[model samples]
Target: MSRGKTASALDLPRPDTLDAGKQQGAYEALRGAILNRQLPAGSRLPSTRSLAERWLVSRGTLEAAFDRLHSEGYVQRVAGSGTRVCAVIPEQFIAAPLAREIPRRPVAPDQPDAGVQSHVPFVARRPDASLFDLKTWARCISRGLLTVGPGVLEAAHPAGLPELRAQIADYLRSYRGMQCEADEVIVTTGIRHALDLIARSVLKPGDTACVEDPGYLPARRLFALAGAHIHAIPVTADGLDTAQLPEAARLAYVTPAHQAPLGMTLSVSRRLALLDWAARADAWVVEDDYDSEYNYNTAPLAALKSLDSGDRVIYCGSFNKNLFPGLRVGFMVVPNVLRRSMLRTLQLTGHSVGASDQLGLVEFLRSGAFVRHLRASRQAYQARRDALLECLGGHCTVSGQQAGLHFVLWLPPGVEEGDFCSRAAAVGLTLQPLGKFCHALALPPAVIIGYTALTLAQIRFHGRALAQLL
Candidate 1:
């Protein structure tokens, strides 16, 4: 276990830990050293001769460990230089550990394959920033600074700026088909902030909260953190199965516009049924309108909030995707009766949105620039979606293609999502598994392909490589 004078700073496996067998023991030790930064990235490894001598093993044994690390991308070998830690560690290596695994369940999509990383092509759901017109946006910011009154300098409403709220209310009415007033719109950061506020204000510890199975993972984790008993409702093609809802559930989170991971719009009948169920169960519905702006094949459906005759819906919307993600601005329309309580809650918690950003966003929406940006981004996204579907559909079963930035591609037979993703990573493809979205229940093996951030050329190029893998 002691370090030899000639050995590199990289921690070698203790001889006792080698009971598992030399290669595995060496691999685990070296991997841990890289991950924990004991062997900082790009640090050169000790000469194989020196390391072998220190470990009291043959040079071939150390080389075997080095070969494994090189193949898995933990380290690289230069033409003249010896092996060194990879300069950019892969994403899979850094993916947050699974918080909890439901016992006896199969491998889920979305789990990061340890040691897999960014030599893989772009696979994340982040919006493409290339299309954003920095010039126009800067002008909008300048306009906001010039036109926004001195009143904006004062301590603002915790909910958000009045002007921005009014603009959002109008935008929702026109685009999302929701009826609401400025007062009902409580602007927060993004979906996370909106949900945090809702969870804090409404969910009591141990209260049952219904979440869509194979749904947004972060939302489920948030609910768990708030001490709600998560009731995972299965998502069918129609959306969250209303018939499967638990009666005791007091809060339900849904992505009705385009279901997360699965692209199906919540059917009108199912939306109404969900609303009715919420009313009957006395539950509040948190409708996450995350990516409602990019409907391609059909006219966008009315939001679930639009059908809330009982005022049971808390409508959430975000500009991060459609505008720019860094904007960190989104709004929620609560029932008039709930507005005061929500505002009070925000004030108490001090979850304030930046006033300058709010003012700039107000100008962006008011100046018609936001709409123009949406129209352009929508067209570009639709093209990318079509290109990706065209590239991938023949090789695999693709679903949820009607809208949204991403869709599900069912894994080929006998290839589980996790294994497929791991294999994909090795060949420079980053794959998101559908399994990671599941909680207590299981879904068919699939991978989510995000088209928005990638170009048509990149999609076609990577798509062919992926098809060969399948």
Candidate 2:
């Protein structure tokens, strides 16, 4: 019998079985393994030496098989990292996999209680509402009530409560290095509302708007709602790639302080180039200055709005990051030239925020309580982040350590991101996949590990669990 026929007896495909050649037979077997998810996304293959031995084939045959898979986009050969299965499997192969469903990992009895609606597993961007100072918050509400007058109760400027605006302006100046005055500040429910206002004021139907590729999804969805053409630009190690920005976009939205998911601060050089692009193109830049206050490593870079020379930047910030999201309060600082028109748009739409909530936040800002809360929260989150890093050592690579509530954890080759997350969720720990954040780009398989809301004990426990799963 031929040597190839001898290999066939071992369940390896014989070289003579197909018209394409020996390489084709090997490819089919490997492809079947991939399609069956026996080798899941981000999983590394055995070395050619090992695979050749297992299949009773030569090393050259295995190499040829790998080359074909790489060419077809079923796998990737990252520099320094070995070959890994693509997170987005090729469409043709995907149909076969859909024939069978991936079974859900059964939840164990010892699992922690996932909220009725929320399956968050120590997720990112979530602040701990339990830590809130109830006494101080109540006192602020009482102060607003006692001091409430007819003027405050009746129709007032759509720009927001004058006191709250002034407080925000002062806070921005001291903390973010933005040199705006009270007239520049406009109160909104949160960043989404702020972006909606910007879209209404600046963007028109068919106007192009640029956003980061693997970015905040809600922002991208908001741009789509405004009838604008959305462009997904790639985010680099530093931050958003300003060079990839279209020269004719009407507006661009970015998170510079702590980039949305990647967490890298926009470099000074990129910031300059972005502002230059905005100025020369006559475009508006929305600086979503979210979560800059919780930086743990270096003092944060000065905000992007601080570098704007042409008054082209619209600065948006929120108390939600430092406090809680349910507060539904945020503020935007528009350029003086655009402030009047933006306010008019807001007024016409009747987007006036609640008077009591504004007054309560105003008190929170004035009484030094906000800064105190920030200081304490920063320390607590830092501890959680440190605990995660400690447990994560040697298991996977973690990035975006400088700021924000969460960081990206890139699993090593041979580990499957989806499978890892499923096992985690089965144990009552819900982890978010990084692929969900991408629009027009494919990122290395990863998960965003948020540490802000989790305590050290929780971090250590979950982190250990995650490490074991890896």
Position 393, candidate 2: lDDT? 81
Candidate 2, residues 339-364, lDDT tens digits: the string is 87888889888877888888898899
Supply candidate 1's per-residue lDDT for 35: 82
**lDDT of candidate 1 over 117-207, digit per residue (tens):** 2223546465677788888778877788778667777856877878888999998889878888898899888899889888888888999
RMSD of 1: 18.1
Give lDDT: candidate 1, residue 362: 83
The CA lDDT at 69 in model 2 is 95
Where does candidate 1 have its weakest 10-residue lDDT segment? 113-122
- Specify the poorest-scoring 10-residue window by lDDT in model 2: 1-10
Evaluated with lDDT, which candidate comes out highest?
2
RMSD of each: 18.1, 25.9
